[model samples]
Target: MKKISRRDFLAASAAVGAAGVLTACGGSSSTAASTAGSAAASSAAGGKSTDYPTKGISVICPWSAGGGTDSCLRAFCEAMGKNLGVTLTVDNQTGGGGILGHQAIADANTDGYTIGMITFELATYKKLGTSELTWENYAPLCRVNTDAAAITVGAKWAADNGITDLPGFIDYCKAHPGEVQMGGSSNASVWHIAGGYLMSATGIDIQMITYQEGAATAVQNAAGGFIQGVTVSLAEARSFIESGDLICLGVMDEERNPVFPDVPTCKEQGYDITYYTQRGMAAPLGVDDAIMTRLEEACAAAIEDPDFVTFMNNNGQAISYLDAQGYADYLKQAAVDVAAAMDAVGL
Candidate 1:
């Protein structure tokens, strides 16, 4: 896959003309028009407030700039701003393993102007005792991307072991218990939980290795043959897979990702394991409902923008858009599921 620079993406987005607008019809007579205009103004004032976002909006990204989350957030924000008719600034407040930035979002004024990108880590921070932050602290706006975890192995290792698919991997793990080391993101991370879930679901034991930096480093180690396999997001392993340095055995999702449709899901391979890292937008708790509605509308339009879709597809990022209420429901279930998995795995 070709790398899409920030500059290139912005240029492409700028080239695409503004999305089409919808207009309402008005009566021909002056008296009728005046009455219609007055009714419209009254309706707008009583319903969704149209005066929101008078100034620029600030989007706090917990991760460092140029990372997957930051890059996707920037692209999404750029597109969203067009719909909102204001600039959305992304501030990278990186520290405390994403806690600082999330806290910033939670602690910011409860206005629609301040929002942030919340990641899967939100489900683990409380369980890990790192912070008291939870999904309840923020009102979810929309879910942008959900990249599923995948089981990938170095080409040489797969070739040497005669493993080509999930069943073969399970057999190999069963035959050589604790011999095949599985590397993923840091301990208690989403990737680590995914690795643990895989083992539990398949009834196989493999030594779990934790990489502090993240899945990218773990994937790099796997491609270099330091480890047998890696349970990381497919996006992180895309380059290696494209170069034939690593082979993705199975994706831990209910359905196969569009970017790698040939790779079967874990369930399709007879293993009932599914896991992914979800990224979405959220505002501080207590934000007005009208402002939330406005934000959600803008988010929906941004995710559907052709330019944004093209950028995400080229970068191997899966597009999973969810509306506000749907996102809230997902967070509730995700909290329960994450807590159970962490406790079972002793994270």
Candidate 2:
């Protein structure tokens, strides 16, 4: 397969965005898709008479209820609804590693009433041969959160091995190669990709283990010494870290996370590795530009809301917001980068 550069990918993605708008406008009139397209075009043409969102909107989440994605969306939608003057209901359409919910949002009527929270799994769906959904399938709205990956070890395991920092951990892994067993959510997951990226960048090798149940189980296993380390979001391991059962070696981010300011970043430890799980809201491919703009503006306000900020801080999730265009650019580059990282791990 040919590699697409960030610039080329963005150009092609932008073209896809334009084509999506055209498809929405020309879709069946009997469907909500057509309404979405026409409404957006009408708003763009200076028609300010349409009172958009007279009814509640349904926001789809690809993950199950009670998970990080679902919880974050519920809180965010509440704040967003306050700004938009309408209720935003979140529906958990879980399955197929988040493909079902994403597809539901993509196939829903483009009429701004239905939107979804697209997760990092969107970038891997194609490469993993699970689903063809891409950034092009949805109209980019705005990014809500980004949780950086962290390398954590069992508290006893770290002390026993004398691994006090990233350098020490790398040295240990280099010396003991496949002896260091690392666990994550699953194969080709964001955590797995982060681990793969770390190995490729530092020339260290370790056995990659997958936990089908989720990162929580994997983190628990690590704390119990069933595994030497875990490459999952710090939020997943926050409880264990707080309990002193696990130690965060380093977070894979450009800067240290505020919730865990005592922990050093991979960059600060001399390795420029940064990887994170991004969650954002996106509407179906033909939402009216006006409606989309309104949604984006509302989302921006929701992110700045004190309640939302408090929710994020209390939950240990990082607040990293990116606008529509910026998010589109990010998805384009992320798809390429994720593919490269997956390939490095022979995924």
Candidate 3:
């Protein structure tokens, strides 16, 4: 797989920013994939309309109702509804570790009435042999959020092991390879891949435990000392961390998270490791470019919606907005990263 340097990514992102505008006519969609292997297929084929969205838009969520992805998508739909002048309904089509719902989204009719949230799991589907679906299966609109994984552990476990910080935790893991048990969300999930990335970067082996139920159970188990720690987002384990039951060793981000400024980054601790679970909105292939542009514009405006911003901030999720082309690029690069992680963990 080819590596996308940050400089090159930035250059491409700049190009997308300058190129992606409100103009729907002949707009260049660099990342939006058409069913015929082109960029953001034409309206003459289907869904061409001047008075589009005269009806409600169905937003498919590929996760459970009460999960982080669901909540975020619901709030975003509300904001986007205000922009699009129509109600956006959330339909949870969850199963197969997000494969079933994802397939449903990709297979949905391209009438511009149905769209869905594509998650980080999309990058791992092909490598996991669960599905052939990728970002190319849909027309990406914009990236909504990114939650960085954290190395959080039971406070008691850390104290007893004299692991005061990330360095100490890494030393302990190196000394006791495969003895440490880290509970990531589920098999092939983003947090589980974070564990694999950690091992690949540090040359240390640790047993990765999967919580099929979700990260909540894993965080609870870690707080109760059933496992050593978890590689979940800070929001998933925020309650335990607040109660002093779980100690965050470090966040896997380039800079410190504003919500938890006290916690340092893994790179700051000399491990230059960064991993995140990304969520974004995308329509099925062949949606009209006019409809896609309208949806994309709504997404851009909705990001600034006060209610949505508050919901994201209160929920401890970071808003990392990216346009269609940028998100498409991100998904493409993520496939490479996830494939490498699959190899690292023998997945």
Highest-lDDT candidate:
3
Residue 178 of model 1 has an lDDT of 67
Question: Which ranges in model 3 have alpha carbons more than 4 Å from their true place?
Answer: 1-49, 340-345
Q: Which stretches of candidate 1 lie over 4 Å from their true place?
A: 1-55, 65-68, 288-290
lDDT of 1 by residue, 162-235 (tens): 99999999999989876888876655556655666676567777777765445666777888998887877777
RMSD of 1: 13.8
Name the lDDT value of residue 41 in candidate 3.
Answer: 22
Cα error, residue 326 of model 1, in Å, equals 2.6
- Report RMSD (Å) for each prediction in the order shown: 13.8, 9.4, 10.4
Better of 2 and 3 by TM-score: 3
Error of 3 at 248 (Å): 0.9
Instruction: Give lDDT for model 1.
Output: 0.71
Name the lDDT of candidate 3: 0.72
Question: Which one wins on TM-score?
Answer: 3
Would you estimate the TM-scores of all the predictions?
0.77, 0.77, 0.78
- Model 1 residue-pair collision total: 0
